[model samples]
Target: MPFKNDERELTSAIQAIQRDPTLRLYAVAKTYSVDHRKLARRLHGMQPRRDIIANSRKLSNLEESVLVQHILNLAAKGFPPRMSIVEDMANRLLATRDALRVGLRWALNFRAKCEDPEVIRSWFELVQNTIAKYGINNADIYNFDETGFMMGVISTAIVVTSLDGRAKAKTVSQTPNNPIKAMSQSTFIKTRIPRHQNSSPTSIYAAVNQFTKGASQIMHQLALLKAENQNLRQANEVLSKRRRAKKTRLRQGGSLSQQDAQDLQDERDVVQQVEQEIRASGGRKPREETRARRCGKCGGTKHNARTCQIEIDTSEEEGSE
Candidate 1:
């Protein structure tokens, strides 16, 4: 019967061989409960058969290395991508190479292998040490941090309205007026409402009788205003409930709003575009046309020294001497 040996067992067998150079392979294998042939292969520094490794991925070593580099670059750019985003990028790369499609398991394994916790901790320590040595302040650190272009871009606007249509007109407007001017106009309109003794019911009744021609019109307007005020109160209550629910959802990291979802999608698209640009550039920087001039003689990044008249004159003087 064929036996299976785990990494720990194999490692123990290798350690036994290292500790006792004169130890036989069969003895080491027996001690570690592994195969004698596997121990012999390990002692001979032979790699295991790739086809027999169940956890071996479909992506080639070179392709996996490139993907890992791409992921690290993105993380350094302050866009620590999600697994879904990584999977999408991987799928695109695989499709181009006509490789097998990757699943969630593959993505999980890729992350586990590429982003080892110990390696990440070492990188963190290095960064912390560098920061301490430089005595960098928060502002300087922020300047160095790479952020998305749409970091603070507005995604939505909220407009409150009442069913009775009066507040609706005030809330939703198309007039291209300055916000301050519009707000002042709204304040002026609000201030016109009676607040003193004139606002009393008895006073209003006396005024209605005195202005006989406008009595019916004034009563009708009062009825409409009362209905509008009731509608506004209800609308305010609904808005308050919605605000509370939104806050609760935000605290729990629940589903996003339509605008927020759209913004995230836009950011993902921007990242994809950047990745495509990087790929198209062949992983090398695009040469600057303005700084293309270089010295042909010494291969320096300055002026061409080969056809210089000054050098020609100096050469002629030396020849004459």
Candidate 2:
């Protein structure tokens, strides 16, 4: 009986012969358990039987490798190729190769043969490793799901048009918050025809336009000025009350004398003046001049008695005398 052997066994036998040119063919054949004549034929560059070969694909090995790589690339971009897309791509590839177009059955069979669990696992691991290597976090990654709209139910024709000669007509209502409801052309024409026949042409064209940008700006300024005027009136009332209280306290012989009251009024006036100046200038008051501190002992502005050079020299002179 002839020895039956697979491609791997035959390939190993050929490699053994290549590695050691002096390697005995019979020994190589014995090691692989294949026929010596078959091994010799393989070594001479003879192709193996179709059943013994690993690849039985319609596409060449190189072409299939390319297809697998393209699929992986699409998967990495979060757009994994679907069966229909794969079929289209395969058909295109086949057309370039002058091969017959493939059907859905072929696509199903191709997927069944190539979609190995191991390959999927490796692809997932590769994506994870790449993300980790580049220090990518969950926040940096994004997923985009596709959405589609159905056009069958939507009307393609224009549903509304202005009855007037104007290309567009402005509608205004006393209630600004209410949304305008859309109406079809037929409903609008039917409803407006009676009103239009009775109404004058001037009335038909007399739609109120929206307030302009300049008008809105003027209204805002007016509101701000009203608030400021109210604030100023309140401040004047408070100042008047304070003045009245001071006069009453003076008449009652309070602890404060008239001169003291006058001084207090002067201080309040100065503060009010500073506030007016600040408001007019639209800025904070200027920093005050810092007063030089007087000495506790001699009332000298330069130095205190503890560190006074003049006092120290005078004491030394008195000791010498």
Candidate 3:
């Protein structure tokens, strides 16, 4: 409904609802003593109260400081604070405007030091503005980006209410809290290609699009391609492992002929040869391992990460001590 009211003529909207053949049944069951025509019209335009979107953290001109202090004050009193502790101070009564100022100021001061952090830069905003100004579709324009994907199931929120209706709690999973992974995959950009190369059939792959700036740009491009190639390689390894595991399972009750292993090795050699030729054509640097991981079995290196045999929860063990 509009903020202001003009009740001159019960709108056409009211007339429509009243005249609608279907609403007659519902309207008959529920009605006020008021005139039927007016009541029907009012229901047509009635709108529910809108809700505001709540965010964990926001830019600190002032209120940010206050919220931080509120959280901190709650923490000091041995109560769990509702607001995030990051870039915030502990202060009670932050919800009230008057009491939150001082704590907010302290938080603002601390935040100033970390103001230039990469996460705060808002890359999406920068990209938008740059595209608007430079026109992203220009012939010479090239898009560049870096990305990472999840290796584990990331945890999210769920509210658990007690049967008694007196207590509630939330929990987190062992996975890391990564904003990029969540936003990119869960939101509109459902699929991602780390980086891509433009290739044509007759000219051969990477035989297209040479940079004007010579070696420097070419080196950077090659490095990006290498990284993308490495990501593809890891995916290939994972796929191959899955295939091998599936084959192993299928052959569990059966015996493998010597020819089967030889055939597999032959296929692998063909793939290796093709990859070598592709790399030779591109003439780029090799891809490097992007992940840092510890061995699961006896803390030893070089093994399958998923099958890590160590069953200890180190974080829990430390807390217990």
Candidate 4:
């Protein structure tokens, strides 16, 4: 029979047998609900089939992780990739290593890993945290309903509405060329109209809505202003502390600290270098220092053989010749 329990249960069963000498394999297997034979095989140092399959997979662990992350990122951005896209991505990654392409339905097996309970839970947590972080309101969130029509059959229809009536505007279907053709279905596009101002309920609701909106806006603005003020105060405190420290250091006959002085000097040097580069007329780079010329005869720097001050020993050269 196929292994009934997962690798973890089987491993636990094997460990249980090993830990207690008196424990029988069947008893431990029964406790973990794993096949006794599989447990025995694992105890004998035989690796699980799952591990073997994982080792034989086309993508390595790290590559698979990267692919999963990429898929998740696309999903978070409201553009979930299709199974074919996943297959193509896997093939691209494999191609980088000059490996053979994955087989058909490889994406199905890959999707199984991403569909784990833990992974799904994490996805929900991520969305929840994001919503909470942004303080999103339920009223501000909207649901989208998508509809499609036959491309050639759809014709532009005029939408008419009365200014005072409560009737909704709708699309009108055009007559088809063939008399036998059935008339296409009409589509309704609802347009919101203001209720009668004389209605007490409507007027009360409008007033309440206006007041709530204004209050919410005021609260939001206050929150923003409070945060900005806090930041500015923090910045001011930092600047004041720095100024005091600088004065104290100056009174002690010291300028900036060693590291600070070095950083300032480096900043000045970078600014000077940038200024020089910017002021340069052409696209030419800064001129490099010229290498000093050496005299071949006298072996002296800054002068070549033609400009050497030392006189040559012509007598020895003539005798040798």
Candidate 5:
């Protein structure tokens, strides 16, 4: 008679016969509804047909399992690889066989086929029947938009580690009082320092940590001060430019409007405030070479047009010529 059951049933029958010495192969086969001859053949070290077909594929069972684990890892990290990446992985695995090529749709088809439609249908049916039996309303049901993961079922975790195996990284513990116990759990350390009320290895480590933290805070404050100084310098330069414009207008015999005079007064107040701030911060105000007095007509420093020295010198030279 033809085999009445699948490979799984045949395997179970063989296992039953092996477990109980008294149980005959024919009886076990009959109980499982598998062919007695096929069960006997499998019991006698015959490999399953599926295993033979799997051996002919590009990736072995072990390699496939590892790749699936890698995918799950990336998914857990919220950066699951796309189908194209999976296709590339397949191509790399089949690199030894130049003639064999993996198609672009291979990964998608494999993923779709992995999900059992019967299992999914059963799950939905179970949920619907429960809701119907309990008389639950739609308002009571809630759906979370985020991905859900089962707690404690996943044993793997992602961690950062150096590539070198010999390099050891020290872990700082939040529990300073129990540093010894915590450090002992993670690493083996030989402590030469004797235990005392005030002085211990843990106390030294804690003190160093506190000092490092304080230094970091001080550095941060210094950075803020430097930035504030830069901002003040920029504001002062702007005010200086405005003052130059005002002086130029006044020198050209242009009367300042009320608004212009108010603006000039506001600029003076701001400059005084900036100077006070610089003095309070123990910083010297940077010299502004742009604000140096220069004659408008000759563009000469140290003398204005009213001083009339450069013009007099040029006139005497022209007269002599």
Candidate 6:
């Protein structure tokens, strides 16, 4: 319905929203899109600062990583990347196009590195502008992008044929993963976590995704990995079954068949042969001897302290006389 009057229309919508007891303030985005700032301006411009609600819960280590991601995303989207707190929300509450550009600029360039105080303040203005343009208080307004960082470029080369002047047959320069970038914090891109799977896919065709878009590149690589994983899984399953079977046999006092016994003997022989081969390759063989008490005087292993040969020899001449 064409708004009967701008003020009347806004007031009606606002009233309806207020009247809906079950409707939540943060639960909707369209509600914040009405440019209430303009409406208030016409109505005496009595801009009042109202407290906005921000939700938070205790975060574990993993949850903290998620929250860091969350903050980074908000920072990317031109939102005030404030800690979980309630405060007066302005620019984002009344979003505008110009403001959104500023926010994006800030995310991409300003926040990427440390800057002079004045530069940071100006960049903050950019962020505010982005928030004003977008008017997205809730988290749904932002988009995510995953950028791959590959390391090696000079290691290989490919030819590119061109049809136009200065663009014809040529080689391209490549940047490694650790390539240098400007030091300023503002000149950064809105980077999101490289997700293993889509957090929110737009369609039923799950396999037909951006990740699977390049059939020759991504799909082929993933296909090889998938095949390898399946092979390993199959091998693991076989090994597990064998181990369980062995345990069952041991529990039941199972006896080996003639062929199985022969196989065990063959395995034993192979191990023994290996050991013998190693020994023959100049290794010392260990001796097996009975343990016996030795006499301290004679350094012998068999005789005890009494009646030792050394003790008898000491009285040999006296005995002869």
User: Worst lDDT window (10 residues) for model 4?
Assistant: 183-192
> TM-score of predicted model 4?
0.27
Q: In candidate 2, which residue pairs get closer than 3 Å at backbone N, Cα or C atoms, i.e. clash?
A: none
Cα lDDT, model 2, residue 136? 63
lDDT of 4 at 142: 38
Q: Give all candidates' CA lDDT scores.
A: 0.58, 0.58, 0.42, 0.59, 0.60, 0.41
Question: What lDDT tens digits, residue by residue, belong to model 4 across residues 1-321?
Answer: 345668778767777777896998878877888888778788889986756755448976546645665565556555556666667777766766688999896875564233579877886787578669987665444330111122232213211112222322255423222223222111111111244446546544554454444444334334434544676799999988876776677689886888766755786799988876775656655643334556899877877887665555675677789
RMSD of each: 37.6, 32.6, 32.1, 29.3, 23.4, 26.7
Q: 110-141, model 5: which lDDT tens digit per residue?
A: 43122579977886787688778988666445
By descending TM-score, how would the candidates be arranged?
5, 4, 2, 1, 6, 3
Question: Taking the tens digit of each residue's C-alpha lDDT, what string does model 2 give over 1-321?
Answer: 456568788888888889899989988888788999888777787776773545435565435544554555556555555566556656655665488777655654563133679987886787688778977665444431111122232323211111221222135422122124212323444455567765664532322112222233333334434544676799999998977777787789776777767778898889988787786588644334245677887788878878867778888999999
Q: CA shift at 211, candidate 6, in angstroms?
A: 12
Q: Per-residue lDDT tens digits of candidate 1, residues 1-321?
A: 355668778877798778888988777777777888877777788766653534546665445544554555555555555666556656656665477788765654563233579976986687688779977665545523222122333323211111122211226432223546446545543454455445546544443343432333333334434544676799999988876776677689898889866755786789887876786589554435435877766566655786645678878999999
TM-score of every prediction relative to native: 0.24, 0.26, 0.16, 0.27, 0.28, 0.21
**Candidate 5, residue 56: lDDT:** 40
> In model 2, which regions exceed 4 Å deviation?
1-33, 47-56, 65-82, 112-321
Candidate 3 CA-lDDT value:
0.42
Whole-model lDDT, model 4: 0.59
Local lDDT at 235 for model 4: 95
